[model samples]
Every structure is written in structure tokens, then in C-alpha cells.
Target: MSALPTTATHEPEAPIISAVKSNASAENRVHGLKLAILLGSLTLVTFLSLLDTSIIGTAIPHITSEFHSLPDVGWYVGAYTLGAATLQPLSGKLYAYFPTKAVFMGFVFFFELGSLICGVAQSSTMLIIGRAVAGMGVSGIFNGAITVLSAAVGNEKSPLYFGIVLGTSQMGIVCGPLIGGALTEHASWRWCFYLNLPAGGLAVLILAFIHFPELAQKKTFSMALVRKVVPELDLIGFLLFVPPSVMFLLALQFGSGNTHAWNSATVVGLLVGSGVLAVIFILWERRMGDRAMLPGSLVKQRMVWVSCTYGMCNGCCMMIASNWMPTFFQAVKGEGPTLSGVHILPSILSQLSAVIVSGALISKLGYYLPWALGGGIIMAIGNGLVSTFTATTSVGQWIGYQIVVGAGRGAGLQAPLVAVQNAVKPSQVPIATAFLVFLQNFGVSIGIVLSNVAFTQTLTQAIPLYAPSVSSQAALDAGAGAGAVRDLVRGHEDELSGVLRAYSEGLRNIFYFLVGMSCIAVVLSLGMGWVDVRKKKDSTKSTGDNEAQEKKVEEKSLNEA
Candidate 1:
């Protein structure tokens, strides 16, 4: 990868030039009203960006119904994460070379554009494209928000600003289901995507007024700059990374379906070619060594490996069944979208509460390992119980089961980050964080696909046995929507019971997959050696060390990227 270009820092003499604002002392990054405005806008942007991750959960059934694309269910959820995971590294580099404000605004524009496309999507393919585009934008939105915030503020007050941002992110996650449900039920599902426009516009408008701090070094754009930027972005590595991954994903999408047998030539060829390409990619990265997108020296570290793997496992545990939670209510229980959202509130709220409580406790006690280990075990138990849920399961049992799963997830989701952060030196924090974050998203995408495969295969068989008279494909065509499957066997109590039973079997398989994921998480957590965050040196010494690290980071421009 090439280095970011350098020149004496100054705004270009152009209309689009950024109005450079200088940062203040660590005591107060920005004072009074200006700081308030910046933080508020950043918080809103953070909320808007993270909101998309969860908002679509409640709306998925509606989307599938409208598009009548049961086979594409995984794509709807996974496309965003796939885009985000692949583009994630490049976003940080873009910020390094490009104007911060311009890059940030460009990301917001992409996000809005995507939302508009999704709002008016005519088919499953269009919706997936919109989701992918939005995910691409989201890959940078949160990072850009932080970068802009970092420029506006100083080091000392960083925690407070980040707290606000993170808190808002939590709010976005919890609120997404209800908002999507309400919109899907009362308004139109399209309204769910449309709503992002006004909110995101407000955030963008607010941000335009805040002149960001100038970089220590920057240069004007030119042909030479583009050449330099390409190398810095690791274009070859990115190219190698995306194609094989897509092929592998395609294999998963078609391999277990009725449309394609597991041993079909297309599936086999994709699998074999993907493996060869993956091997080539690894070899090229090894040859590139430090220049690789995933630098060999860094990845070889035990903690980095553990953090990424552990995080991926935790992510799998969380996402494998989450997309189907609403489907359970809507399809199995005959609940409306709005009521289904209401029903899922227990999981969301419990997870949120657990996150807060665990964060406080972990900070106070100074040990994250116990929480990480215990969380996986609890999540495994929760997933097992969840898999046991049937069409006739009682309300309290389902709610309590969801609570257990949520609590388990909340308790451990942040633990891997701590492991990664503590394991790296200050200068390496950015790269480490980026790697973990990418793997987390990668995990979500893969887990969702796995869920889809298991559900598809299970339901394909179950449908034939239960609704023997009704065709399997036609039943699946019902799109897992409320009463859609039941509608197929209307007035036939035994058939309705059998059909619902088939759905319950498939959905249960998804949750059972999650149980295995949680167990893997447990093993990974065991591999993460204990580290106490509270055991730091004296404040003055720590500050001096941080200054030294900052100097190293300044010398290495890629660190900033």
C-alpha cells in the first residue's frame, strides 16, 4: 500500500475548500455551544448509520412478501454486511488522503441515495443492490463521524464524546425494530427506507457548519495523487479479496436450494475456484508482507487472531437467528408486523440493559474474560431453549427465552474489542480495531447465510411431509409473512398444524445453528488471555507515553488512515 501524500497544510484557494478550524487544549476540546453542536450532530449521524443494521429486521418479512423472493432472504440481510466488510478498510484510507469533510459528505450522499433506491425498489435484486450501496456508505459513516469528532476535539475529553455517540448507537439498535414494524404495519414498508432521508439530511446540514481541524499534512488532488492513492488503498489485495468471497457466498446461496443440487457443476466450480483464488490471495498477501491489507506481522499476533476469531464467533451467535426472530412471530404466531416488533422488544431491551450493566461491572472489576466466557455459555443455553420453541409456546416462555439470549449477547459483544485494544500498542489500535470490526461484519454475513441455508434445506423437506398436498415451493413462496403459510392450508386444522410445524422446524434449525456458534464463542473466549484495563500506570506517565505514541503515529501517516 502507498503512503498518503504530504505537503504543508493549507486550504486550497477554491470554492470547495474546507474552512480549517484548529483544535483546543485537552482540558476542553471545544467550548460551550460549538462543542455541543458538533457532538449532537455526530451523535445523530452515528444513530442514523447504525440504525440501518437493525431496522431491517422487522421489515424483512414484509420485504420478502412484497418481492415474493424467499430464496433471496439471506441476500437482503447479508449484502449490506458484505459490502461494509469489504469496503471498511478502504474508507479509513480515503479519509487520510481526501478532504475529511468532503469524504464524510460523500458517504452521507451515498447512504441517502441507497435509501431512495430501496424505498422505490421494484424487486428483490433492486432492494439487495440498495442495501449493498447503503452498506458501502455505512462502512464509512461511523468512522467518518469519529474522525471528524477526533479532529474537532482533544484527547482528554474523548471518552465523553464517544459515550454520547455509542449511547445513541444503542438507541438506534433498540428502536429499529419498533419503527420498522410500525412503518410496515401502518404505513408502508417503503416508508422505513424513506424515513432516513430527512433525518440524515438534518445530520448532514448540521455537520456542514462545523469546520473540521486541518490535517498536519495534505496535498492537492492530481493524477500523481491518484496513483499514490491506489497503492495506499491496496487495490490488488482488495481485488483478490472480493471475488472469491463472492463466489463462495454464491455457492452457499444455491448449494442447498431446490434449484441446485450440492454436487451441481455450478456449485462445485464456484467452491473449487473460490478455494484456489483464496489460496492465491493468501500467497500474494504473504509476499506483500507489511504492505498487505492484512499485514503479516500484525495478523500473526495471538491476540489479533483471537480477537478477530472471537469477535466473529460472537457475531455469528448474535446474527444467525436474529433476522428470523420477527419471522417467528409473524409467520408462526400470525402476528402483524407491528405486534411482532412489539414482541421482539424483550430481546432488544434486555440486550441493551445487559450491555450497560456489563460495561460498568467490567470497568469496576477490571476483568473481561469472565464476562466473555460466561456470556457464551449463557447464550448457548438461551439458543438451545429458543430452538425448543414451538408454535404453541406460551408468551412468557418465549419472552424469557429471548431475554436470556439478549443478555448473553449484550454481555460479551464488547469484550472482544477490549481484548484487541489491550493487546495492541497505542499506534496499532486503529488497525487492530478495523480488523476486528471487519471480521465482526464478515461473521454476521456468513452466519446469516448459514441460517438461510439451514432453514431452506430443513423447510424444503419438512414442507413435503407436513403439507404433502401443497407444493413446497408454493409454500415457501408465501415469503414467511404473517398467516401466509397458514393461508395455504386454511380450514384444515391438521394441515395448518403440520405446515406451522414445518416452519417451526426450519426456524428452530436456525437457532440451533446459533447454539453451535455460541459454543464456538465459548472456546474462543477461553483462548483470549485475561487482561485488566484498570491496571494502568500513573496519569502523568501515561500522558507522556500517549504523546510518544502520537508522535509515532504522526510519522506513519497510514496510522492516521
Candidate 2:
């Protein structure tokens, strides 16, 4: 087996000449234009995958009402997330075995098919299944984009491209809720899913015309060398890992409210089962070495571990804010869902600005550590300020605080990826990037569960305190049933105002917990080593030269002996 091409051997400016020398420059220009088109198309595909998550969140209430179940509603989100998480590790395997273009294009088809199914879903179960399928497709799309982008630009330019790709994806997330809300209000909630069809179709058309040399040819895996060069897909790992993750998520979504208690046997059983399965899976992976779904040695690296942790923490904070802010506006601030979605505009804009500015600055300055630290601090402060939110708080105040939080999140989001990519050997970049994303998604799931638990507990306690005269039965009825509490308050506006105040206070209390989480993330950000993205090309050149020199000395000494 021959070694892969290195940065030292690959020249960016090597020109290609066809039979006619007169047309060489024209050919090069055409090639550059095609490359730009390819990047744009791939970026759009990546954006679509991320857009689905946030876009659907704003429409959760509509879906729940149509399906007639709140308990099962979380699955609308969870199903997609579970499928994405389960398939993430396999992306690397698919990339290694198939043409990158084929793998990406195949996943896009799956994603489109799933979206079509979701748009016309007649029941909650069908929607959940559609979401899961979509997730399975999405799991590979963004990872494939990152892999292709890295290959296109080489390692020296990867950080800038990584930042650009990530920034674009985050923009999709920011736009999703607003777009979903507009479509759901003026058109139909179904259009939220239907909208992806045209966007995805256009992306497919664009990509077809844009050629990717890296994915132009497919490679076959040899059975004899498979165990040594690439580990077989760990079916057993999937079986063990997927169930526990699902069970754990189920327990979180269902073990609260009237369904089950925190200490109930069903909840306990699921929790314990998940823990045991996770332990067994880890042990199994340790024994398998290179064959593990998550290679232990790679994870043990300091940079990898810290990057995963930071990613998880950042994910948790972002998920909590994204999920709860709309609820807060609707429940306590007396804003309609559509209005609430609009209110988040400032946060979204700020996040977008931060992402673009951060990318450009990292590309120019080359240092990412200071930005990471500053971002963490901003996030903590923004969250802490939000803890003071009250029913009387003005929209301007709310949006301002949210923008601050958004800036913090945006600034910190890309730094870890840049740091981790810089730390590892080029061969490990795909796996490392996938692992970081996986951890972040895992964190989002965990955050939703924990925040849901906190909100439920706080509301339950506060409702009774503010509405002592209301019968326990009425309070319970209002708490468990949708629109019940809102109706109750509307009927007795004077008395329920106090109850609304209490609910707002309870929600604010949860923000305190979020602030604490951000602070912990701040401490962790300090541990991520510094790297200068601006000087990355020069640095890599020097390092490669030193390595080549060392190899030459060893060769000369061997010949003399």
C-alpha cells in the first residue's frame, strides 16, 4: 500500500495543459468557477440538514395538537436526533469505501425522501419515523461535506473552510424557526417540510454540474486487508448502543408529569438498563481496539477529550436556550408562538454575525484561544442576565440579553473544531470531527431532558403556591392539559396574573442553572490549547520541512553503515 499524498508533495499552483496551449488559462478559469460552484452546493446541502432541527421546533405545538399527544411530542425531536447520533460514526466508513460524491448524493436522496414522508405524515408515529429516516440521511451529509472540503483545500486551509462551513450551517439553524413560523402561520405547517424539497433539488442540480476529483472514483475494500486497514462495521456495537440511548431518552421524556415519577420502577429500570448497556459497550470497544465504534486510544488523546467535553457543554447551553425561550415568551410574556419566534430575531442575527466575524478573524489573526475565552465569558454573563427576566420585562430587554448569549455561543462554537483539527494527524481528522459533533448532539439531548425536568418541577411547585384557592383537581387538570392553564388565567385575569408571575420566576430560576453551566464551560475553554489559524499554512510548511530533513538524515546514516 502506498502512503497518501502529503501537503509537502501537493502543489496548489500546478497548472494543467491540454492539447491546445492557447486555451490553458481558459481551462484554469473554468476549473476555478466549477470549484466555487461545488463549494456553494455542498454548503447548501449541509445547511439543509441543520435547518431541519430548529425549523421544526417552532412548530412542535401544532404537531402535538394534530397528533393529540404531548408525551409523544418529544419524539418528533428525539427520533431525528437518535437516528443522526446512531449513524454518525458510520459516516467515516462510508467515506472510506465509496466515492464521496456518491455517498453524499445517496444521503441527499434519503433526506429528501424522509422530508417528503414527514410533510404528508398522517400520524405522530409516521412523523417520528420520517424524522428518524431524515436524521439517518443527515448524519452523513455534513460529515461528508467537511471531508470533501478538507481534501479540496488540503490541511493548511482546512480551518478557514471548516469555519465557513460551520458558520453556514449555524445560519441555517438560526433561520429555521423563523421560516417554520412564517410558513406555519401564513401557509401550513406541512410546508415547513415541503420547503426542503425545492432547496434540496436545486442543490442536487448544482452538485451534478460541479465535479469533485476526490469523490470522482470509488474504492473497493479488500476482505483480506479489511481487518487491518479498516475495521468492519460493528453491527453489535450499533445494537448495544442504539437501544440504551433510545431507552434513556424515552425515560427522560415520559418519566415526568402524570405519566411516571422520578423514582418509579419503569424509570429506574430504563436508567439502570441504559447505564449497564453503555458500560458493556465501552468494555467491548476496548477489547476490539481498532474495530471499536469509538476507538479508545483516539478518545484518550487530551485534545480529543477536551474538545468533546467543550462541545457537549456548549451544545447543552444552546439546546436549553433554543427549546425554552419560545415557551417562556408564550407562557409567561403573553406572546403568541409566532410573535415569540419573531422575537428571537435579534439572537439569531447576532449569532450569524458572530459566526461570520469569528471565521474571518480566525482566518486573519490565527489565534482562537482568546476568542474562545471571551465567548464563554459573554455566554455566562448573558445567561446570568436572563435569570432576571420577569413578566414586566420589555421586549427590548429580552432581545438584548438573548443577543449577548447568541454572540457568546457563536464565538465559542467553531474554536474547538479548529483546535481539535490542529491537534490530530490528518488521517484522524474525519473521525475526530465526527466525534466532536456526536458529543455536541448528545449534549443537546441531555440538556433538553434536564431542562424539561427542571421546568416541570419548578412549575408544579409554583402553581400551587400562587393559586391556593383553586382546587387541587383544577390545578392538576390545568397543569397536565394544554390550553387549560392559559384558559384558567384568561378567565380570572386578576388572580392568574400572580400565577403567571410565579411561572416567569420559575423559568428565570432555570436560567440561573444555565448560567452556572456556562461558567463551567468557561473553565474548560481555558484548557483548549492555543493555535494561530492565520499562520497555519506557514507553520505546516515548516513542520513538513523538518520531518523531511529528519527522514533524509536517517536514510543517509543507514547507507553509510
Clash statistics: count for each candidate? 2, 3
Q: Choose the strongest candidate by TM-score.
A: 1
Give a tens-digit lDDT track for model 2, residues 412-443: 87788888888788867777888887777666
Give candidate 1's root-mean-square deviation (CA, Å).
Answer: 6.6
Residue-level lDDT of model 1, residues 340-372, one tens digit each, is: 878888877888888888889988988888989
Worst 10 residues of 1 by lDDT: 6-15
TM-score of each: 0.90, 0.82
Candidate 2 yields a Cα-based lDDT of: 0.72
**Every candidate's lDDT:** 0.80, 0.72
lDDT, residue 162, candidate 1? 82
